[model samples]
Target: MSDTATVYRQRASARPRIEAEPPIRHVAVVGGGTAGWMTALLLAHSGYGPRLQVTVLESPQVGIIGVGEGSTSWLRGFFEELGIEESEWMPACHATYKSGIRFDGWSTRPGHESYFHAFASMLDNLTMTQFVDHVHRRLDGEDVHAHPDRYFLATRLAHACKAPRPRHEFPFDVWYGYHFDSVLLGAFLQRKAVERGIRHLPRHVVAVDRNERGDIASLQLEGGETLAADFFVDCTGFAGLLIDKTLQTPYVSYADALFNDAAVAMPTPLDGPIMSQTISTALRHGWAWTIPLTRRHGNGYVYSTAFCTPEQAETELRTQLGLLDADVPAKHLRMRTGRVEQHWHRNCLAVGLAQGFIEPLEATALMLVQRTASLFVDALEKGDLGAAAQATFNTAVNAQFDGTRDYIVAHYKTNTRTDTDYWRANAANTRLSEPLTRLLKTWLARRPIVGGIQQGTFGQGYPVMSWYSLLAGMGLFPDDGELRAPAAHEPPHSLAAIDNLIQRSALNFPDHRELLGAIPPRPREESLQVYFW
Candidate 1:
């Protein structure tokens, strides 16, 4: 080891084999909505499965801000990992079947008390000790919804309208999710990423260039077409064209812990069929949401332009949704939650609403845009990305958008409704983040259940039957009665496998228009749909 350390280890072993990342053959995906063709159809079904060449610029006068519609149950494994076929995209997106979301009158303000949080994953090990002993005998006074009561199967399939059936092993039978029509799920994933070939440019990026070691080397459309790429995803929504406008990078603003910041949206049409679930309610300054979508029934409200006054929150959201056009024309928006501290800055990567946002209630804006394009194709198929695997994939997609913005700010700091002035001003303009104020004091003292998958968002939050159905449907049930004894710590004898998984989920639940008459529809712009398989 002499002579300049043997020529610096022979010029670092003849340096020259980065190929600058592989498989992502010429991808672009600036913004097509639904997180730009769901990250260009999962990077064209992984590593450009069909001769890699995705495109999707989009912006024919920019639009797609179709707020969330609702989803979970890992969007049925992201439509079978993109081969797609939930009967060809849930009836062209009129979709319906979400067995969750009721949240009515969010505690205190006219609260008639509620709790079910179902999407089936009814904790195993003697069905979460007999569904916490039927929610501690419905808080010691029985009536878990009366009559030989059983609690949680999303509370007996919400009075038996049922819906999720086909199962072989999804944590174990019928745990569903889907509401659909957020602009027909971005036009049914932009027509199945153009019949699985993908390529569209519509235009309107205006400028993106970058390269002095800054990375994102192309895209400047607006008629002067110039789209180049090795990689770049920035679903351009909150105008962050390539991780905050050509990499100026720097976002992180849960406005001191979420302040509602205004919203409006509309659609209204429901009369029948479309209502598998999704409601929200709770008003006086914020929180509305409805959502049915098989055609229409959206509604939104979201409040707080510093506490009401968007003409008094659209006149209290058209006097609690009677709506004669709930103050007519809609989709107002104002946002200011936060994220993008670095959803991969250099070679560009900022998915959906340009990486970070909270306040869709739940339905996690296309599940963090298919979990940031399936964790950036599992860190580019372990090929090697360095900068510590891009800071561990931008700290695991910024801890899944800051652990779902602290579970949507623990649904407004455990709101017991301070009656108005936006529930009498709380959530102190976003100051909670000390690990979500110590996981909301062990999630409001139930002690331990701080998101398992072993904490810190990567198994993407919500589970424990979606925080046992939104902190026991916002009544926040758990002052430590040790969940009032389900045979005080175990065995009630195989607890009849929760009554044989509720009589095999009642002869395998059906009727959501008979599972859309058993899957089939693959059309778009609406019409011809099915998928009960």
Candidate 2:
């Protein structure tokens, strides 16, 4: 070679080479559903290339709890990262846009019985400071309208039955999620993962085998075949096959904090314009969720079996839906509300219902699954699944689950309803996590909640705006008689101005139904292959 060419070759040889093989060559995800498929897909997309093999061993006999589901904005990021288009999966899954949740009858306080918990948006930055200021003013006896619904653009869009998808000309981005058929979503994800070269085994996992280190060594199939991998993912729903049954991990229940334990779900015909919001109405026993899909409305009554029987819940739900005499069947689900002591144990990581479930009060099920799968991928890539890395991952995941529990528990604890024994019990019960207690203390003391959360080790699941919305929406404030006028120098916080801004901003989005209609149907060939998984 020439002198210049020889020098360039030497310099190139000195550079570090990328590792072609990942530390964990193969990962076996046991169970199939949204969690299983999602875990598989995320692993396949984790930049490990063909070196990291992913296998999903799903039981054909185990039916998925295909309830109507809503997700947080995390799911939008999930799809975007996977290069899946809204038009592609949304249409196939019978999905619709969700701006946020509309809570009704959770409180009996006048003018505060209903509130909207909106997903945070870029536009919130424009008004959050003023909103927080008004909240402080209202707490200090000023006659300010600090209701969160009036302050958020998502609430406005939801009220107007508008999609969160802003027009191309709209400068700011609006973050939102979706309501979809869970079964379809799982299938869609499975297809995507399979197309990306992930292996799928439609076989029953009859037994789990452990090595000398007590790590999951292999899974025994029904016909005596064995499937082994370097790592294992437990997506076995609430059964927690590997994490709970196999690993013998300890479970910490949240029964003292959250009372509702059972849910009865049934579908209702779409009766009106599709709304871009989930409706959570407090019922006699617990609460009812109304999730609107493109084809139907998914309605469920989540209550405590200790308070109401399955038949009673179904009857109440039927009464609510005006289907008391209708032949529509309701699917009842028993929920275990809590988390494992450790999410990542040994060579196994748990995802989905197997990880633990808080009541679906906030539609956080799928969001948690997404977080777990993504976090596990990052942990594995960074530390090659070492003990220290596992400990750190467990801490983060456990914190998230506990934090979510605290938030959901607050929903019940702060409820202003006393009509039912259940509601009364929730309000009277004092079993609260330290973080929630401190945060509540901060709010009641008229201190800055944001500061309290920032200062302490608060659960990092929900944002500060969410806490503000929940507490303020429930009218958890001092009595009006205790109020006094603002100081002369205090600048007025105009409710009309906020309203005007939100109203005008909402106009930038299209009607919810129209937006759903705009998404063209998936190709016939793809639709035909949807169930191939």
Candidate with maximal TM-score: 2
TM-score of 2: 0.93
Per-residue accuracy of model 1 over 407-486 as CA lDDT, tens digit each = 77777777776667666566443477776676555645544442332444322354443454455556555434334444
- State residue 178's C-alpha deviation in candidate 1, in Å: 8.2
The candidate scoring highest on lDDT is 2
Tens digits of per-residue lDDT for model 2 on 1-533? 11111010001011122365677989999998999999898888776766789999999889998899999877876776666778889989999999999999988888899999988776777677777787787776777777888888999889888988877677656668899999999999999988999999999999899999899999999888999998999999999999999999999999988888999999998967899999999999999999999999999999999898999999999999999999998899999899998888898889999989998888999889988888887876664677788888899898889888988888888888888899999999899988888888878888777755544466356666788888888887778887677777876677778888888888898888988887642222221100000
Instruction: Quantify all predictions' global Cα lDDT against the true fold.
Output: 0.65, 0.83
Name every residue pair that clashes in candidate 2: none
TM-score of predicted structure 1: 0.32
Clash numbers, per candidate: 11, 0
TM-score of each: 0.32, 0.93
